[model samples]
Target: MNRKVIVTCALTGAGDTTGKSGHVPVTPDQIAADAIAAARAGASVVHIHVRDVETGQGSRDTALYREVVRQVAASDVDPVINLTAGMGGDLVIDPANPTVALEGTDLVSGLERLVHIEELRPEICTIDCGSLNFGEGSSLYVSTPDMLREGAARIRELGVKPEMEIFDTGNLWFANEMVAEGLIAAPPLYQLCMGIPYGAPVDAGLLQAMVNMLPEGAQWTSFAIGRNQMPWVAQSILLGGHVRVGLEDNLYLSKGVLATNAQLTERAITIVESMGASVATPDEAREILKLDKVA
Candidate 1:
């Protein structure tokens, strides 16, 4: 009962789930609305990823990001805004010529991926730690060591805390190196992404090992996709970490039930409270994470 958990609800991700669930937000207005609703539902933070309004695909458009941030900041309810700076790393290789990048490829420099983050300067932004074979396809997510070093330094300069995204043990190892090198500030933030194909498998032993490897005083959280989502919430809390939920990593409230951002947030709160841990408010989360109030 002495624990206070920060609940972050990722409103919409840059995934291909818009077709699978009608509740997935597409436009800036929808994303903003979802963010506000999630805040009202007891979420201390809202993780955002804009999408192309017409195509409903994930986008890196600065304008779309500006609009979404504007609406959320202007709203009555306050939640720590965390933007995704992990875009522009997709590399779909051509089957005919392995050296050739495919049409769907959006590979760019790590700095290029931070265009919006550089402009908007939210309280927090994510930095994917390493490259990985993204899912079952020719697609690969790239973030080399050089790219990570540059990106981490730039984010520190911007006064935006970088949420180091750890997809595997190797990623965690490199992230620890960055912390040791003084690129990341005190109390480094980490997001242990589990159940993502070709990354870290959904294993509790692996999660515990990664937790043991974290830098001392590091603030961390873990999440799994699909049905494993809620269970991971309990697991993360049990292991002395925060929690993240929403359409980004999960879509169902129960079997055959699609969930909205707010619904997922409420569910996460229920889990937290039932576990004898209270959900932190926006201001409380800011203090816990050492983030300045941007909005």
Candidate 2:
């Protein structure tokens, strides 16, 4: 329990949570402010996703990303920046015509999804491993095997560490296959996402099994949404992995208490410290994840 734990604060996700919690930052300035605060509060990394200023919904606009990164880069703190390349894969299918996509769909090519990543060139970007029923609807997050392969190879070529996002056992299996094919470079990094609908449930035994399935020398982190956020920090640490928390996954710090990004990160640090493990600094996290520090 004397290990150093890397704490990643996911500032804002592409989920429909902006209305649910006032703490969820929408504009670039707000997101950047939250990131700087979280880093000052002892988070090792900041996972970012920009939102449209007017609609308050998630956006893949490179301009929005540019603004957010610019603000954070100009800030005093220097937490490792981890951009979300998991956007542009959402496909909300039409009920009658399954072949035709619905309005909510933002489906695009795998390379298209990396447009922002290519421009920003952050230290870390995410590639969701496989497709899944995103939530309790006709929505399906599409990341086909071919798409994943193309994305991984591109990310590797760009010299950005790709965080293989494992939603379920199938995603993990495909990720291993990518490693075997030498698409993912040495010291691969993974994020074991749990408790999302139609994905891996929040079960310790299942998490242990997934951890066991990971290739040797792989660096991994895990997180669950809603009430499971705080508990999953200990769960990930106990299983020898890093942790992520923030408004993206959970709105409340406790029941009936809406929490900000900084608050969640502070609580995560407390948990890590209480368990006899120290929270990793940004540099320490870069070393652990084998990331090339952006200058």
Candidate 3:
């Protein structure tokens, strides 16, 4: 078993999860608080997504992002910040008129999506490597090759690491191509995203195939949504990659148990230690991922 696994807590996501669980943090203060608590609970990093405080809907407001980053920066616990630059690519098309943009449509220039990342300059940010049919709805999350190039190049210029979010083998293929093309910087980080409908399914064999497709010397993490979240943690660690967990992915600590970010992180640490491995501290994680530690 690999010792020194890095645990990343995804504080909140751009999902309609807030109404389902009271434990999901909404306001910036709550998000930051939960992030700090996760770090204290043994997470080496925290992935972040801002939501409209009043409506509890995922948002792209840079002010909200600024505040969340600011609070996390000021906290005594210094988990590496990883902001979601994968917003604004959402497109909810209108059935009435296929030509018309729907109410939930959020397509924008890739640079627009990075406005917050450009300002915050977090140690790491995400770029969804490919587009996919989001779900049952007519919605699609768009990340074409041209957009990927722009996002990857911009992230390179900003001196921030891009978490290549691989939703499928094709996404992985293009991500590898980006690496080969020198669009993305060296020591690339890939996140094997699974269990999302219309994306890669959560199967051991499929996950293994995706893992096998990773580039040489690439730092990677993996997670599955819902009940599979915790199980996938062990799968990822055993496969020689880091793990992610939090309210963003799974809501239950157990049957009828709602989970907070800290609890999820604590559980992941327990799993790691139980396997005769240890959880990596932020500094160790930084070294492992080849990140430049912030002072």
- lDDT scores in order: 0.93, 0.94, 0.91
TM-score of each: 0.98, 0.99, 0.98
Cα shift from native, residue 168, model 3 (Å) = 0.9
State how far residue 241 of model 3 sits from its true place (Å).
0.5
> Per-residue lDDT tens digits of candidate 1, residues 1-295?
2388999998889999999999999999999999999999999999999999999999999999999999998999889999999999999998788899987788899999999998999999999999999999799999999999999999999999899999999999999999999999888999999999999999999999999999889999889998999999999999999999999888899999999999999999999999889999999999999997664
- Sorting all predicted structures by lDDT, with the top scorer first, yields 2, 1, 3
Q: What does candidate 3's lDDT look like per residue over 1-295, in tens digits? A: 4677989999989899988999899999999999999999989999999999889999999999999988988889888889999999988887787788788889998889999988888888999999999989789999999999998999889888899999999999999999999987778999999989899999989988988988898888999999999998899998988999999889999989898899999999999999888999988888887786544
Pairs in steric clash, model 2: none
- Report, for all candidates in order, the number of backbone clashes: 0, 0, 0
The C-alpha local distance difference test score for the whole of candidate 2 amounts to 0.94
lDDT of 2 at 254: 92
Worst lDDT run of 10 residues, candidate 3, spans 286-295
Best candidate, lDDT: 2
